[model samples]
Target chain A: MKQSALLDHPFGARYAAALPAADAARQDARETLALEGLPGPKREEWRFTPLRGLAKIPFIPAASADDIDVCDLPADVPRFTDAHRIVLVNGVYRADLSDTASETGLTVTEAKTPDHGVDAPLAVLNAAYMSGGVTISVRGVVAKPVHLVSIGAAGAEPAAFHPRLAIAVAPAAKLTILETHHGLPGQPYFSNPVTTISVGTAGVLRRYVLVREDSEAFHLATTVADVAADAKFDAFHLGLGGALVRQEISVDFVGEGAAVRLNGAYALMGRAHHDFTTFMNHDMPNCTSSQVFKGVVDGESRGVYQGRVLVARHAQKTDGQQLHKALFLSRGPQIDCKPELEIYADDVKCAHGATTGELDPDHLFYLAARGIDPQAARLLLVQGFLADALENVDDAVVRDILSGEISGWLMRKASA
Target chain B: MALLEIKNLHVSVGGKKILNGISLALNAGEVHAIMGPNGTGKSTLSNVIAGRDGYDVTEGQVLLDGQDILAMEADERARAGVFLAFQYPVEIPGVTTSAFLKTAINAKRRAEGKPEIDAMEFLKLVKAKQKLLSMPDDMIKRALNVGFSGGEKKRAEVLQMTLLEPRVAILDETDSGLDIDALKIVSEGVNTLRGPDRTFLIITHYQRLLNYIVPDHVHVLVGGRVVASGGKELAEQLEAEGYARYLSAA
Candidate 1:
């Protein structure tokens, strides 16, 4: 595809033409794509991020199908025991590869129309050509976790994959979902995915996303949540991989008495980069939202966090808090954090803070004096820095897995 | 044999002379009290002996059992069985007291080619030491010196010294922020650790602590050097007459 053809509009013709016909939400997707042009380093959000490499890639529709071998998952791998397992292979849903349906409270089908409103080009791209997006509906309270694994298969040729997912929590329902991403080695691909979540009245939904992809991969994902009255949404994100990764989370309190807690930890090393941008909109009264993001960057890595809490005029009694802290290990690494609170309501308590610093030298000295090697001292301090975020995870099993992954990543990076 | 010997030590901080040509020798099983007024570099002497950074040792040599200790780093000095009970203990948050002490003890052990103690064994050691000091069990689990009272912090210093079992223990004003009861408890803990193979150097301004932990030798430090060295009677004389006459003569 010619560069001009891709630049003619926000949603390139190649992207629109490559979208499958089965995706019925293409119109809303296209409108969302009209929001912005291709991002460059000049853009404020893309300042520290190097977009030149992305701009150089030719725009082409991902090939229809390719042969991809599936690796055997570990025996102790986390799986949603009660809910149905949905597997998306190379941005296309493969029903034959997933487990059979088992429960009545959970149902997975293709989205007929996008219910959650999103006005971003990335969202449009995900909605437009989304190959096998999953639409999950939980009717009532459910006692199991839903495991959604996105597996990116290495094709004979390089391509881009966009996956879309929608989750709806019915009234008085409770559900926990673990969404994970797995990519094949030597597969140089871009994953632009979007997930929409709706929490009904008196419902509770806990979502966790664990992203560990090939080091050369590009991941751009956005999660949009719409909460109802007296609903609770607990979301945790763990970012440990990817050459360049950006996850944007936007939440809207459309009903009164809704509460949301957003906690995340990102541990990056080498030349890897990660960005977390969040926006919480309060449109009703008596709502609360809290967000905390902690990151550890070593080597030449970089981390970025931008969070904003918006309180509408009529949304009185809104309580919101946002905190972002990062530890930069090496002098070459950097962290950029911007936390904003925009409140139009008169009676509201909103606070935000951002801090970036190196590891405590005294603490390191003390640890080293205790006979721990310098590298082990660093690992302990990093673990301490990320302890608060990990504490927010309710499941012990999941917390252990996450902690092991972080420690393993650190060890690997140190060894390299 | 001398356990710790400081030969003509001259030290300065921020270009100001603190310890000028001060010399002291501490033999095993000896408890030597070095009494001086404020600004006389008593704390500086202890810090210099402990190898704390930011202090310039212009001309001096600290020998721990005849080894050049002034060239060692603070941790190296610590591993070499030199412990300094600070006048003001630093508060380290997020690190438990028991954890810190265990790490220190293990470090010392590793330096001596000894195997590390198991968790249960270490816990037993902590229990014994806590009981000896009459400290609450919760103090061990709390963050190191964080939110600890003055006396509690002093007791913690003593507890750490007992656990580490250093060859030369330098108590830098351990009695400064302690009550009569706490002082007695701390002195008892120190007294229990006293042996022919260990040396104690207690830095203080008052002789009250000496009443509990009797010093075998007393040194009156004036103008950063020992101006008067005598038996334990020196402490009583200074307690009764004060250092006013000595300061004027020096």
Candidate 2:
């Protein structure tokens, strides 16, 4: 995957000088990408889902694609009428299509450079070309959720966009954020985004993310969240589409008594490849973190779940658990699951499990005995299998939306 | 014509003969109870009739209104008005009981050229059936049979039977894991479904459930064959003497 096939976007010479806040960090990230290009298959982390297809693409820095005009939010955006909306196209915030009514206890400002420890290649790539991101700071409990919709589109030529977002919740604050990553149906587009979240003392942050890129799109997103003492952070990531999509998340518990629940589900068909790589760093004692991820693959697609829970030497009484289960809808598909637990503390408790299999014949027979035809029975069972992991989603509306998306996928699969 | 007929039905599971030449004729409006001892192929008869997989009908004929039901798929037989309330209903996680009920009911309804049941109509029908089975309203809201007590599973089975109202209902050990109250409630639900157009084959080891639903005819099954057949008094006779007489005859 790392063969100098795809040329680098000039962040130092072309874009970094104009971008505010993280100019130096952007240069550093570009250097990191230059030093460590997209990790090859030899790297154990990238062994499951290689970036050969990504490397073959002639992706120009999305910033250079000035002709890529995003006039409106894509039609596939899940409509939640209650939540306030914030729209971003090609990494730039579009105020005209956004709704910020009665958004008290919330302040949305210009993009600020993200300083989340030194370099992951994609994180640095996001910083190098980062533009059109928002800094959302919350002081008090927000009544309604703030919906962030990031749209990606390329014109005649293949393009890419790097969107940055920094979210901070003050002490004793409560907030819910729903992000829908969508793309227009045209030329192939690459969306590389970095999102950083900071939760304060005793604060609660519930975030749900949906990545539904177009079939011809590439999306590599990195999300970093720091949870303070007595704080609770719950996130559910849903990866539905994209040519080459990777959602890498790092959740660090900075203070004792913090809790983090990261759960996600993905359904892929055709030749799509999706990778969900998560790192739960327990730097403080008495922190509990759990992750449950499930996926369904069909039509020669591949899926990978790489979950690593790192418990530091001083982080005693830390409880970390992760489980990944995948269902194969067809014989052509492949799934790779790696659950790594690096526990350096003796008093720490950790567990990990991974299972990959097809639908149970007994379950199918039970459904068939109830008069559900095999096709319909399969749809119901597949929906149910993913629904088990979707139970982690607490929000009713988002859960319904995710369910509808799955149904949509199923119907499409059936028709295909 | 009999509503259902099993003619010389011989079934084998994995090369071993389970049901050997068990023939029975169930007329419309008749409630026939099959009382048998352990290892007597009680469930094999029901599964073979209902068209379950794995059990090979080496030589047999399971007829629904004189049409060969063994030739049809399990779901096809179901759409043909054959229902088997499983002895041990499966626990299917994530598929809600309400949804399962609606799908099964609608599948039959669709076969009859009826539209899919609307939400309100479905809710009303389910609510009424739940009330009939004395099942709690929220019972259907949970996953099908998952985390349910033994009584709840059997009651759910009866609830499904009441909803589907098949022309031929086979209650296969429906009273196996029931306590006194669940047995009464489940028997009452089955009793309510009994009618002139419907025929029932109640499979049970004990004669207790026959007291609740009062079969018109009782057949003694032992060693994979119907050793004897008679009126309701035969069930009483078996209860008194146990199946030792029938067990020896085979």
Candidate 3:
């Protein structure tokens, strides 16, 4: 193994001593993290989103902070009807707070040590010091959806935790999962979570993620999915709160005739910063992928979206599309959007679009003419703008929940 | 006193005069029509009364029920019982017509210190009104005015006027793009709302609409001023002569 030059980095010797002794896999990942420190503004992929704020904080491991204890889920977390609830506090699964009933053809277990390497800086950090996670295996069509709620809190000092999650769906099986990431308001806490998903041939998986961490928290999540022949992967991500948050998702088609739909929406205010980075790799023939992301920025907040779609030489009959749109509520906010398509195959269909604009005065005046107040009119227009993206969510129940969350955010903004 | 009185209304758009010394009084239980050529400030008159921005009111006072409405914002004026039926209703995507209607109704109700309309009650009310306007039941399910035909948009305006029951309703070219059947239906909807407490100010460049909903009074607007005022015959005379005499006189 090559020696790491970044010994003084945050994820280096400073916090590495607090974690348990690492095995070979963790050691290899630690070496990788040391070699390539946290992404900075110099990096092309992370130019818009600088991690210097996160790097400046002196964060100790959450496991070493014994003073923090969360015995109950936050009241703000929605109670999904007829869904299995799994709770995670500071990255460790809490059985006492979970109400997961064992269903047929589905099994859940504690995730093992990291054995696979994901080529991302954050994933490398997560592999180095992952505290705890869950491995969910689906063997047949599951009747009820699974809800995984991750909560973060720091007591007496800024803390950080890395969690690893793995999901596998057998051939011809189907499942749906909803993940909600939340945190309490206190000393800043950082959550670094890595999720690996695999869908067998002809299987289906629907994943919905909602990240609404506390305003003083930082969350960086990495999700990589491998899809096989004729499988379908549908996912929607909704970001509402966090001081600084980045959700990076990448999908690779390993077999022919697979399809993927990755869509997301975000609302930011105050000094919050949110970034969404997506990569779609079509290495097989007859594969399709589409992405649609929208955001609303207010106050002095910032929003960024970077999408990269790649079609290999042999990947004929590939179809890929991406679009990003943002609305600004005030002059103090900033938005950055970049879409890159690298297509090497001639027989492929690819397109991308990005737009940034303020609310239309005509629409506002029209609503105002109907006796709707100015604030109420703006809320309606913003919701209408986001509705275009939210409509992509296939499930009506989940769509309603996400819409309610957006309304709540808007109400808070109005009051603030 | 007239229900809606406009006194010496002088309006300008972008520092250029549009309506110069325009005066009219619409009495209670009366329907008044203002007919003029295309550039005669008919739409400006309606827009100024509706409190749209960007129109500098150099010297004017629009009184609704004896309260000056020019000092109010567009939405405040709307809640104060002023409605303007747009010629081109805005197409707002993702906002269902049902939601917008409920919100508008609730805003008016709240202003009047009344409880908001419940879902069932609102549904019943809107369904009845929609039927009267000959609108399909699923029209409310779509986005507000999005993908709606011209006739549908006009009918929707009538539906809103009926639901709000404003004291003074100004229709800006309501007959512009309507077919004969749509015109009859829209006129019928407006005629049903005519009563002792309601007043109508119908602004149009054509007299064909007056044939269906005959006005109690007609005024000929030429060169930003009302050069002539008479009872229903003026609309017919202007239509027959095509405003040529009045345009030359102004």
Which candidate number would show the highest lDDT if scored against the true structure? 3
| Candidate 3: residue A50 Cα off by (Å) | 1.1
Worst 10 residues of 3 chain A by lDDT: A1-10
Candidate 2 wrongly placed segments (more than 4 Å): A1-22, A112-118
Screening candidate 1 with a backbone cut-off below 3 angstroms (N, C-alpha, C), the clashing residue pairs are A93-A132
The TM-score between candidate 1 and the true structure equals 0.85
TM-score of chain A of 3: 0.97
The candidate that wins on DockQ is 3
Candidate 2 versus the native: TM-score?
0.96
Per-residue alpha-carbon lDDT of model 1 for A1-416, expressed as tens digits? 22332323223665566545534466656654544455555555556666556555644445453455554443334454554567776666667767745677888886445555566546766765565577889988776677787876556655677777888999899988888786777656778788889999999999988888778878889889999999999999999888889888999898999999999999898888999989999999999999989988888888989898999999999999999988888888878888888889999999998888887766665554444445656766676667547778887656666777776677777787
Model 2: DockQ vs. true structure: 0.69
Please report how far candidate 2 places residue B31 from its true position, in Å: 0.8
TM-score of each: 0.85, 0.96, 0.95
lDDT of 3 at A326: 92
Docking quality category of candidate 1 according to DockQ thresholds: acceptable
Model 1 lDDT tens row, B76-167:
77777888887877666545677677767777788889998899999998998999999998888887788999999999888888888888
Using DockQ as the yardstick, the better of models 1 and 3 is 3
The B-chain TM-score of model 3 reads: 0.99
**Which regions of candidate 3 deviate over 4 angstroms?**
A1-8
